[model samples]
Target: MATILSLSNVNKNFGALTVSDDVTFDMPEGQALGIIGPNGAGKSTLFNLIGGTLAVSSGTVQFAKQDVTRVPAAERCRMGIARSFQIPHPFVGMSVYENLLVASSFGNSGHHDAKAECRDILDRTGLLPKANRPAGSLTLLERKRLELARALASGPKLLLLDEIAGGLTEAECHELVETIKGIRDSGVSIIWIEHIVHALTAVVERLIVIDFGKIVAEGEPSKVMADPLVQEIYMGISVDDTAA
Candidate 1:
């Protein structure tokens, strides 16, 4: 498959702290890839680097065969990259529909009938019923839905989901997972960073385990999860030790 996004020896530093250490990976076109690791392992940092919110310290980022390491976030969005935050903070004062309109207008240049497209996105994300509701009035799940809707309105080819399922009920998470599956089925590539392994596994074709800003493992979800190194990162002990 052709690569949609590629990071070559990407690195990010905040003074003495190196958040991304020569991170390199490729996201195949139309693939949903899951990222898993302990907290502070540079998961979000990688997203930032990919989405153009943060520049790489010493590497290249390519999107659709174009070098975008120096691209601005807005330009990248217009170039088909969009992301949701771990904690959604949508336009609180605006209605949900309005939020989508804003995103579509900005991120989807030359899109005709953005309103119709936004409506479709609202329906797809299960946010149609609340489209007229103020964003600030939404519950956690609703906010997350709105976040996904807004990203869709941006017309993304690659969607970056950053812990969007962090605070949902089991039922709520399942609903979101189904919605995400629909998105993946619709051919939107996804890079989901989530602690909820089941949710990621349900929607992603592959899994990558990151530690200290580098990919520790990458493969099919089950095999990657079962790797002793991945188990130690998650369980804090070798599987042999745990069994013994």
Candidate 2:
């Protein structure tokens, strides 16, 4: 598979504080990658760099084999990169379908059939019944689905999801896991940063564990989670935790 996204020796800093330290990775087309780390581990910062919301202090970001380190966020969106925020920030006043239409127009360069495309996204995200409801009126689970739907409306080849499954009941997370699996099956590459291990493992082919802005472990989900360092640092578990 060809690489759809690549980060080489990436670094980010805020004043004297270093947030990302020479982070690097490559994501192949149509692959699903899960990222797990402790809070304040710069996981969201990594997403910001890839999504063009933050400028890298050093290193490069390449997408679809093109250098996009200096590309503006909107241009990156037009270039087929779309992301959902850890916090769902939908347009409260806009209907669910209307919000998707806005994303479709912005990300697809005013595609003529934006409404049709949004309808499809709503269906895919299991929000068709709430399509006409005000976005703010939806429950937390519904809002999360809308966030995913809005990103999908952009027709992205690479999707960056920031904790889309956070704050959900077990049953709701399971439902989201199935939806995400369908998305991966449809051939869109994904990088999901999530704390919910079961949800991430259910949808991703590989797992990467980050600590203090560095990749400490990466491989198949089960193996990565089982690593002594990862289990100790990120999961805060000992071998006995598994045995128990």
Candidate 3:
């Protein structure tokens, strides 16, 4: 598989605080990579840099073999890179279908049948039945589904998901896992930042653990979770603490 996205020596700073420090990785085409980390680990900041929502202080971001380090967020969407925010913020007044239509229009670039594309996205995301309903009236699960649907409507080749499964029941999360698996099977590469370990393990082929703006482990999901450093981060207790 060819490298679809590459982050080399990427660094970001907010005044004296370093959010991302020398972060680097290569994501292959059609691969689902799961990113797990504690709060304030800079996971969201890393997504901002990749999606062009924030400027990198150093290093580079390449997508589909093109250097997009300086590209604007809208342009990145046009280039087949789309992201779903951790929080769902759909247009409160618009119908579910209309929300997706807005995304399709913004990222169309005259290449796809936007109408058909929106319909397909609705179907894939299990939102077709609610197409004409107001987005703000939906339940939490429906809202998250709509968020994923809106991102898919843009026809992205690389999708960045930020804590998408944060607030959901086990059954709802399982439903989402299946939906994401279908998307992965359709050849869209995904980088999902999720705290729900079970959901991430269900769909991703590789796992990456980040702490303090740097990678501490990468490889198989189960193995990485069992790593001492990863365990420490999640358990909130160090090895010494356990020993004592």
Candidate 4:
């Protein structure tokens, strides 16, 4: 498979602290990759670097065969990279449909039939019933759906998901996971950073574990999660107690 995204020798430094250190990986086109780590593990920082919300202190970010290390966030969005934040912060005063329209206007750029596009996105994200509801009135799961919908409004080729399953009930997480599976099956590449192991494993083809800005493990989900060191350090459990 062709590579859709690649990070080489990536480093992100804040003053003297290295939040992302020598990170390197390649995402296969149209495949889902999951990232897991404990708190303060620099998972979010890695996402920011890929999504162009933060610049790499040193290294390269190549997406769609183009070097984008210096690209601005909006330019990256237009280049078919779009992401949902860890927290859903939609335009609270706007209706769900309207919020998607706003996102399409900026992120999609020059797309026609915007209404139909957004409507379809709402349906895909399972938010069609709440299309006219104010974003603020929706529940946590609904907000998360809206965030996913808004990212789709941009027509992304690569979607970076940041802790999207956070704070969801089991049933709600299942719903979102199914929706994400639908997206993945439809051939959109994904890199999901999530703490919910089962939810992440359900969708991703491969898993990478990060700690203190470095990847401690990378391989099949079961294999990585079964590593004794990873199990002890990240999950705080010995390998014998549980199997991934």
Write model 1 residue lDDT over 1-244, tens digit each, in one string.
Answer: 8999999999999999988888888889999999998788899999999998888899999998999999999999999999998789799999999999888998845568898898998998788998899999998878988888898889899999999987788998898899899888989899999988988899998999998888899999999999989988988523433576
TM-score of each: 0.93, 0.93, 0.93, 0.93
What's the true lDDT of residue 23 in model 4? Answer: 100
Give the per-residue lDDT of model 3 (tens digit) for 83-154. 998878888899999999888888734536788888888997889999999998998778888889998888
Q: In candidate 2, which residue pairs clash?
A: none
Where does candidate 1 clash, by residue pair? none
Give all candidates' CA lDDT scores: 0.90, 0.89, 0.89, 0.90
Superposition-based RMSD of candidate 2 using all C-alpha atoms, in angstroms: 3.1
lDDT tens digits, residues 1-244, model 4? Answer: 9999999999999999999999999988998999988777899899899999999999999999999999999999988899998878899999999999987988845568899999999998889999999999998878887889999898889998988888888998998899899999989999999888999999998999898899999999999989987887765522422553
User: Which residues of candidate 3, in runs, are more than 4 Å off?
Assistant: 108-111, 237-244
Q: How well does candidate 3 match the true structure, expressed as C-alpha RMSD?
A: 3.3
Q: How many pairs of residues collide in each model?
A: 0, 0, 0, 0
Position 93, candidate 3: lDDT: 97
Q: Which segments of model 2 are wrong by more than 4 Å?
A: 109-112, 237-244
lDDT by residue for model 2 (162-240), tens = 9988888898888888888988999989999998888999899899888889888899999998898887886453343
Superposed model 1: Cα runs more than 4 Å off: 237-244
The alpha-carbon deviation from the true structure for residue 155 of candidate 2, after best TM-score superposition, in angstroms, is 0.3
Q: Work out how many backbone clashes candidate 3 has.
A: 0
